[model samples]
Target: MKIKIYFRIIGLSVLFVLQSCEDFVDIDSPNFQMVTEDVYNKEKTTIAAIQGIYNQLYVANFSTYGVSVLGAMSADILLARTDTYLPFDQHELFSINTTDAGFNQNIWSSAYNMIYMVNRALEGLENANISDDLRQNLQGQILFTRAFTYFYLTNLYGDVPLLLTSDYDTNAIAPRNSKEEVWLQIESDLDEAAALLNKQTEYKDGERFYVNLSVVEAFRARVYLYRKDWSNAESFSSNVIARADLYGLEANPEDVFRANSKEAIWQITPDGVRNFAPEEATHFTLHVNGTGTTITGNTALSDDFLNSLVPLDKRRLWIGEVSSENEHSYFSKKYWFDNDGEIQQYSTVLRLAEQYLIRAEARAMQNKLAEAISDLDQIRARAGIDLITDSNPGINKQALLDTIMIARKRELFAEWGHRWFDLKRTGKVNTVFSSNPTWQNSDALYPIPGEERLKNPFLTQNDGYGN
Candidate 1:
């Protein structure tokens, strides 16, 4: 299918206004070179370019700062430990505001930048006469990256413009597509990618950080679950589980987040990419290590959140540290750099433990209560909990689903920006999230960054933003 590339901002608006007449001459310049003929000509170079895309995933300001740090920590489940100057404590960092003291352009720019790279790679591959095998590998990588990004964008901002192509000179002024349409595109891309991706290729560091067929299947399953397609969700998730030889839960819950661990289906390895050591303070909301005056200082793991951890569960002690003073409850131990403050070794994205949670939820939805419990037990078993065979006798299916949700929260706590999405997707946003009064309105679905809206007139704010 021919997807039209849109680059409306190329010649329009004030950005173009300041350019000289020479700039206009270069606007339609064909001499700029094609990425296909120029970049992807060599197999090694093409693979390196793909690796560069993965490198971009490690940028702290974009992935770590916006999504993992802010989006993950600012949930009601977590509280600010210090009250000094954390922008997220007030819940204004990523929100839409007429004034400009704090605006989160990270989500907007990061996703688009990543999308731009993927688009370039994809366009380059399509034009290049690469071999079918290598072409499929590169194609799968780009498709998975695109789908993963759009999924995050769709969840954060309900309705988003689906810009499929990167050709700026032709299509422009693309209006916002409904969440359903975006999701459909995402599903199509992932399905295609899953088929094309290789399960045998190991990542540079020999971890599952790189996208593979299994990871794409896992992603497809999660995406289906998000759209409430239980059958497809179960199918994809079950497929991944059936390949238990390839991926499964870690032996210990703590090992899942430790520096190096097997059983990782997909993750973003923080290798020579981006170091969070010096700038780790800015990446997190508050100083989990209590050094930064940002969100970490203002907030911490809530006592209720901490207390919720079962006694035998080692994850509670593994994932957090007690506050120096008696003021804050629990500071996150997940992202701490352990090379005596020299190196940061952690995966920003995780899959194994989360996949189990996903399977459990799907099984519960299908009323396979025993199977659901079995999935839950896989996670619990590592955490030192007995198998949940006879735990629920009188509770209904919905109640069992609720139990699954709680288990998900406990199992995947603070790994990625999951809690908020889990709460929102389950239609429990208004119900469970109501305890904190600020998190009201559909605007909770992330605000389109002001800069994006300012640049493109087609993008509309979610309802209740202006009025």
Candidate 2:
């Protein structure tokens, strides 16, 4: 199938400009008959349709800013420098107008748009006259994409409407599903995705840009870890770790974000023109001028969080200092680019380090202290930090878990809101934020977007956010 088939089916004019390849088949209009006949009939067009779902990740609202920025700002790892993002930085998201059209609104609407696209592709593939192999592959890709989107949605908003169909009527009136139900669906999707996807070794070009079997397994490990399914989490994470040839940890901490690094299980490339650089770089990088660079970023590493990193850790190299006339400030260098001025960095959604953390936490929960310590030590060794040893430390299960949490904060800080999600999953949001005068128990979950509530009357706002 040709890319036009997807654009026409979704009525997306913006995507039509992104495609440079000549159309394989021409259509007189974007009608159902034309799309069904021209798109669903061919394997190429069907693959292109699946690619459309991946393309959505490059959108500003999806991974670039919505999840990464909002997630970081709401946590202790990153601090907002201006009033524009202060609401999130100060934990005032509950105070934002439910009806306001802003980043929050964009995050909600854009995620659902991606979900709808996946569902549409799935619907088309089901009835399309295609081979079993092609059909299964497409199904796996679509399911993984849907599950990924829902993981973010459910984490941010607690409960979300699960739209599995492309039909507008069905989606419009769909009620919010419980977080448990949504998670169950996510697991089911990942299970099916794992069954259908080709292994990482089978992927051409060693690409981490698209979903593969290892990516599915890694995500399954993460989902299980979040659900406290310790044994399954450890097993799934161990499965990914066993495939070291394909998904080994990068030797250098800075190399993890480089394009197609082995550490990355899944990453999203920047879109053609508008999204030329990783979105996090814009907020985290210092401003450069004639005199010297100044740390005038929209966001920066929080002082308390920055102080927590030990000098011996290789991960500390990811933070840099810039000096102006009389003052100095610090910023994150995780997304820094090379001197060549090309966009060689990608926003990594999942990586090998996280799998190690997942297994460590799972092992700790299962009382496999020694194994958990070994996994933690592997990540620590890469970071140039002191390893946890049975002889050097008298570590109990709770103490080891605490150590693992701190390791996670230092290892994964400023990367896609891992700190924020970690705190929420471990039931430490209140304990961590109790010092803030404005902090409330209900602030754990963001309010459901107002426009969505208005569109679907069945939708209810999270507690403490009045409907």
For lDDT, the strongest prediction is 2
Q: After superposing candidate 2 on the true structure, give the runs of residues whose Cα lies further than 4 Å from its correct spot.
A: 1-37, 94-101, 198-201, 270-275, 288-295, 390-393
User: Per-residue alpha-carbon lDDT of model 1 for 1-467, expressed as tens digits?
Assistant: 11111121221221111121112123442222343455566666666666666666665234655565556555555654444324444444443443321335645655666675677678767756568888998799889989988887887778877877655442235578898899999999997897787564445456666777777887888988898888888888887777756666677654665443566667664345333452233333343345532223434666777778888786765555543343334556655555555543456365667777888888788888788888887877787866677565556788778778888877665655688788778777677656655655553676676565665677777764551
The lDDT of each candidate is 0.63, 0.77
Error of 2 at 32 (Å): 4.8
Give lDDT: candidate 2, residue 353.
95
- Model 2 Cα lDDT, one tens digit per residue, 1-467: 11122222232322432221112122221224345445677676666656656665666374668778878888888888777788787777642453223667777767776776676677778887789988888899889988989999999889899888756666677899999999999999999899888553445466677778888998999999999999999999999899877778888987999878888888886345323567678778876467664446678788897789887878888997777876577788888745666787888888999999999999999999889999999898898778887344558999999999999998888777788999999999999999999998888888787766765689988987786
Error in Å for residue 182 of model 1: 0.4
Superposed on all Cα atoms, the candidates' RMSDs to the truth, in angstroms, are: 6.6, 5.1
**Which residue window of length 10 is worst by lDDT in model 1?**
1-10
lDDT (Cα) of model 1:
0.63
Q: Quick one: best TM-score, which candidate?
A: 2
Clashes of 2: 3
